[model samples]
Target: MYYSREVAHQIEKLRKGFPVISVIGPRQSGKTTFLQHYFKHYSYFNLENPQTRDLIEQDPQQFITLNPKNIIIDEVQRLPDLLSYIQVHVDKQQEMGSIVISGSQNLLISEKISQSLAGRAAYQNIFPFSLSELQMHGLALPGHLDQMLKGFYPAVYTREIEPNEFYNQYIVTYVDRDARLIKNIQNLSQFQKFMRLLAGRVGQIVNISSLANDTGVAPNTAEDWISILEASYIVYRLHPYYKNIGKRLIKSPKVYFYDTGLLCALLNVVEPQELATHFLIGGIFENFIISEFKKELSARGLPVPLYFYRDQQGREIDLIFESKTKLIPVEIKSSSTFNRTFFDAFTYWRKNIQAEISGYVIYSGLDSQKVGEDNLLAWNKLDTLIDHL
Candidate 1:
């Protein structure tokens, strides 16, 4: 029942050149499963086990002695001290494909790697399953609207368990273990409240002071918590796209959760049926699609420069992909019925930006069509558009 991931080949390519490769992502995003399936030949260690932790802590040299090349270390952040030792060992052995590390907390692992294994490691972020990966597994591609509500988490898509129970456990585990392990925040209740508040603000320009006011925390504290979330790969921030466009662009970045299931769970959305009638349904859809597009780009080892375009004249596009030479504008709608009025913002983008590339209106529809030279595509076709881009 395991579905192949797009990052598998990238990991293979990385092993050929780098002695150490680190796969980082949020907890339960399938990092351990991916490494275990792909790197089965390598000896594995899970540092979460007290025996393994004690062994590494008591005698670091012995830990290295046990790893006789071609080793995969799970939860490597638990043993950050061992990274320097591994760096030295790999340099001396002059070996490639000998060390692989996977951790759920990117905040801790990336810091250690930067300080200890800088320029000696290849890093990759493993998000939950994307639309392309789901299609590759022969699963019926859920329409964009359904994908938004159901989310693309590995467990959710596989239907391995009840969505409600799975999401409930995910939130508890995330708050209890993942958040605490990475950052020293003693206020678990406050953190939980902040997460829920963040869910309500999805896909909007983030106002730190307003969030601070709502959460009853200092502005600086709110900013710090957001950074911790972003660093841990739980959330993504989309900056505004402006190239001296002669307008006062919004400076604050918009934040979106990496997976909609987590977002929905935080918002207490127990079912897709519940989400369909919820007030935040549209925002949830926007958040889901944008995050999926971001994941697709990362899976292909490409930089995701996503932004939203807005002008002082009250015209805006929901999402914009900043390419090498052109700005690709897109609008996401929750309705399945196509209408000509949906292209208004897109027309504004074309007329004002003067970009030749046609814009897109992504909706909850089955058929892909063209409306006055603009592409009107369904949500499931996102992968195809990305490939053709």
Candidate 2:
């Protein structure tokens, strides 16, 4: 139904100030769709087309001259050389909203843009649909407890496609194409294996050596591959937050897939029913909700310094939001029911930190309630919390 995205306003703001705006995300995250919907009058070109690529490669200056102003260049990474010409044109013209570029491979596109159009461009990452956007279109699920389990991919939500077939094709076509072709990885088989292993280890602390062991590759190779995945928006590595606390917090980062649907696809999770019984259901659910929260924060142009609280003494909080000199701790439970034990970690965190501590238990329940002085919020209410922030 074409629900409006939070990035629309950001893009509009950037258009008023910058000559170029680059929208980067993984393939099929709706980058093209978004730009087409927003910039209807802008001339469009997909560099993936051989004729278009050849025209740009043959003479970038002429290509720029043909479409002088307000052009939308789709898959710009396919012709990285054209960015240099674009930079020169934007610098000479000094016209705001002159160009918009979209691509899936951030490693190539971002690096070229940095070198060519460093201060001349604004960048944004376009993730899949958010809960608020879905709600705006009146597509809110009646019982959204299963939302985190199945995740919110655009095609999955809009079409009546079988989850298994949809996800299977997504892995085979988009993920595989981007990982091997766009990233230029030599070991396709090993890369696929690495992805599947990472899916199983979602929401866990990053351990490259352990991943290397599991993937039967060198530690350095595993680390480099993870970077490629992160650069391409296939995965995200959330660093731990520690300022002056003397006690040793986790120095390592946690890994999460940008889209939980892709993660479930890698794990062969077909539907919500299958996800509920899966062994990694809890971890997957945690990853889903946390990633969506991060997306919400980014949509509002806020820094997401999200982390988990874990001590050597066996106490842990699943997600921690450190803002305005306070610690907001959250625990995510895949269970539809709540228990008193969920507050134990919150109690420990409150006792230790001098900062004001508030706790929330985000569960797969229909109704939101208070559990012994702590707030218990439903998964659907996540957008409300973000708005209140």
Candidate 3:
């Protein structure tokens, strides 16, 4: 059974305008299944097959002849050299939706696309699964601990698989495999340590030197590993929202994992209830809220950027969603109790900022109400807030 994906709408629209449409994301984000399901009318080719890959890499002419036009190429990053030939055929034919390519790594596909395909292809990134889509899949309103530990991955919900075992294999299959594919690593154990430590730092500002020291690797290796993780969609770094706020600011970006399940796997919590008393519960909650907001924006084709607010005086806001006219500030809390203090940061910003801004507090509480200038939202009501924002 296939649940719906919001990115399908964006891809359908892009197919009409561009000759090539590419979807790039982390492994198991359903890039291959989603595209194949949508474009069943098009010829299918899997470059991961040795025979097909050999033809494409060793004999480009024969590969081109075999795949004439209107084809869907799976794992095209496995053989990016074929993109030049694709570019030529699309230009000569001048047909919209002549080729659709899906790859797990953004590093190779994006660079090759710009160098070869240029204006001929349109691209978008697909995340694991959004809360809204999970709801559509008949999942219940998960407890705070359950949500954090289980995450929003599609396979976990669809197949009813154990999240712990699934994420364990996920790390071995994608994280370890991708690192080997990217660079020559003398120690696989050290590389795994780098990822585990990085996951421990989710929702916190990154320190490359500290990470390297603890992982027993050099700073340059840590930097390169961070790039590889981002390129493969395993992590995202949220830039600080900086403006003249009458205080000096820290520009170091906060790191967040794409799926909380994978982060928890590295953290080694076996059960969902463990998240309740876990040391990083608050950080995990913050990560979940921010990632949920990201999926909403990506689904609607919104290009707005997300930012975090922190000042030299120690004041902070968890998320800042910016648009052309108004800036929306959101504070995330793991406690189910609704507290007035959550509005402190938003209230301060409302008074200081001279432009249009809206304030919101999203907590695990069941009650939803309006305070003086800000609105308090229950966790389950997040989908409605996405509509308004």
Best by TM-score: 3
Query: Could you tell me which residue pairs clash in candidate 3?
Result: none
- Candidate 1 has an lDDT of 0.82
**lDDT winner between candidates 2 and 3:** 3
Model 3, runs deviating above 4 Å = 244-250
**What's model 2's TM-score?**
0.92
On the 0 to 100 scale, the lDDT of residue 385 in model 2 is 58
TM-score of each: 0.94, 0.92, 0.95
Model 2, 1-389: lDDT tens digits are 66678878878888899999999987777788889999999999999899988978998999899889989999998889899999999999999988999998889898999999999999988888777777777765665435553456677776888655666687667556777765567777788889899888987887889999999999998988888888788788876656655422437778899877678888877667788888888888788788889888877776646888767675778887877666678899888787778778877776786435568888877678877657888877887556545
Task: List pairs with backbone clashes in candidate 1.
Answer: none
Clash pairs, candidate 2, are none
- Rate residue 125 of model 1 by lDDT: 85
Stretch of 10 with least lDDT, candidate 1 = 244-253
lDDT of each: 0.82, 0.80, 0.83
Q: Please give the RMSD of candidate 2 to the true structure.
A: 2.4
Residue 171 shift from truth in candidate 1, angstroms: 1.0
| Cα displacement (Å) at residue 126, model 2 | 0.8
Error of 1 at 137 (Å): 1.9
Question: Candidate 1, after superposition: displacement of residue 286 in Å?
Answer: 0.5
Backbone-clash count (model 2): 0
